[model samples]
Target: MRFKLRPSDDAFYEFFSKAAANLVRGTELLNELALPGADVQSISERLVEVEHDSDAITHELYNKINTSFITPFDREDIYRLGSQLDDIMDHLEGVGSLLYLYGLTKLPSLPREVHEMVNVLDQQAKLTADAMPRLKSMKDLREYWVECNRLENEGDRVYRMLLVRLFSGEYDALTVLKMKEVADELEAACDAFEHVANTVETIAVKES
Candidate 1:
């Protein structure tokens, strides 16, 4: 251990960020069933896999946050950041679970559109992770975070349009409901990402 080392606050942000990236990858993997031979089994199996991955990262980050003597922001912010980042993975897990529970043997192209939104969420997570260190300079990166918010807003737009398309579709009520549930979760995950961005921005202001 070096004496008088600088505190590394971004670890809290970075660990959860791996958690976030896996969440998007998990969604994309499942959504790949939008093609052939992709069924409920694939979704369920992937869900379990991602759940284990996400949970491990969350626990590790939580431990790091609690044990570390230094963080750039308040302890509560650290906790909130970890939880919110983990939440995106949780939402993706929910989507996979719903696929199994709803008995959706086949995937649809429309949900793929929302999956595209996950890519936006991916960018949000990256921006957030990048911006946390910016807390060291987060003041200078407020506009950078605002851009992440814009991505979240775009996610909101995609969710709304997906819902509209779901209702307009020829699918049955249960199908519509399942689609709605998936979209809600994806949208909520994106919202949670925005919350992380907002938290980062706030921390930047207070620290600066």
Candidate 2:
């Protein structure tokens, strides 16, 4: 076991856990978009609400970092982790908003690979939510970042396949453009999750 002289600031850990849980909610909303005859506008609105909640949590965390003399880890790391988590939510909201705005929901169905991308994000979100609470101990975190990287690679593959499907004369030119934008946001969310994991790995290494 490793030991360090750090304050017993559970609030920082709580903030992280809350933000991660919010991510789980965001991904769940995104998954609803994959269902048949799903209501895109409602999901988009709920996602926006969840994104706002994440923003509030991040704001509170930043304020905590400013007021607290001692933090669980580097203050910068805490902020980066919070920002990265928020970035994921932003991308999620973008996915929903793009679907509604571009009227992509009117299609009979979305490509299978797009849902695969959502599945990857859903896994990442749950993994992150599970890992954030463990930051208080900084134990068993190696699996989190490792698996997150693997999932990101998987998401990349799905994204590439989605683009191929999008551009293979399957969709109209304008529709392809709209879906590509949404795909970009989904891929970005996958990368953002990896960024959070990488930051957590960094904090664990520094404290170890």
Candidate 3:
């Protein structure tokens, strides 16, 4: 029995980069919505566009996977990457929808920190994207993946603090629920980013 190694595709890496960019852009827009008197609906529409673009990239990648005789890494890695990337886009879109659904004309006092967390998460997302193309050079890229992990951990800390603030707030039940939902969406996006980092880490290990 023989195990076969496959050559990596430049296209796959590019698609991965686009996925990362979508998440970063979506989160950046969400943070922008925090501006006083900001037009959230307009920003939400942009997020919708970002989500759609991510879907297109994922679809293209899957099509490539089907036609290729072999994948650059494990087929499971490719699948996980696609799904996790989609997860980020979906969660970001959900956050955008809530802006309209909750009719949240203004950012809650509590979510202000969460928006900051999203900014950091966006940076992490972009860093992860940068590192994806460097998967072949695992030894060199290890630091980037580590930094991404730390940034995600920062997001978790912010989430915990936000939760505390939400529950302790003087808001009505409905407002609290709305705030919680948005905060969770932000956390979910960051969690998806962590998934990307983990997937990249796994790919590094498997390929090396």
Model 1's alpha-carbon lDDT is 0.71
lDDT of 1 at 95: 67
Model 3, span 1-208: residue lDDT tens: 6464677578877888778777778778877766677787888888899899999999998998889887777777887898898898899889878876788755444356766777877787778767766765456777877887888889899999888877885667788899789889888888878888888888877766
Instruction: Report the Cα lDDT for residue 7, model 1.
Output: 63
Q: How high is the lDDT of residue 59 in model 1?
A: 91
Worst 10 residues of 2 by lDDT: 1-10
Off by over 4 Å in 1: 1-6, 9-14, 105-116, 126-140
> Between the candidate structures 1 and 3, which one is better when assessed by TM-score?
3
TM-score of each: 0.77, 0.98, 0.90
Model 1, range 41-126, lDDT digits (tens) per residue? 76678777987888898899878877888775688877777787677778767766766677664544445566676677667766
Question: How do the residues 1-208 of candidate 2 rate in per-residue lDDT, one tens digit apiece?
Answer: 7567887799999999999999999989988976888887888899999999999999999999999988888988998999999899899999989988888888889888888999999999999999999999899999999999999999999999999999999999999999999999999999999999999999999988
* Top TM-score prediction, candidate number: 2
Instruction: Give per-model CA RMSD.
Output: 4.3, 1.0, 2.6
Q: Report the candidate with higher TM-score, 2 versus 3.
A: 2
Q: What is the lDDT of residue 142 in candidate 3?
A: 74
Which of 2 and 3 is ahead in lDDT? 2
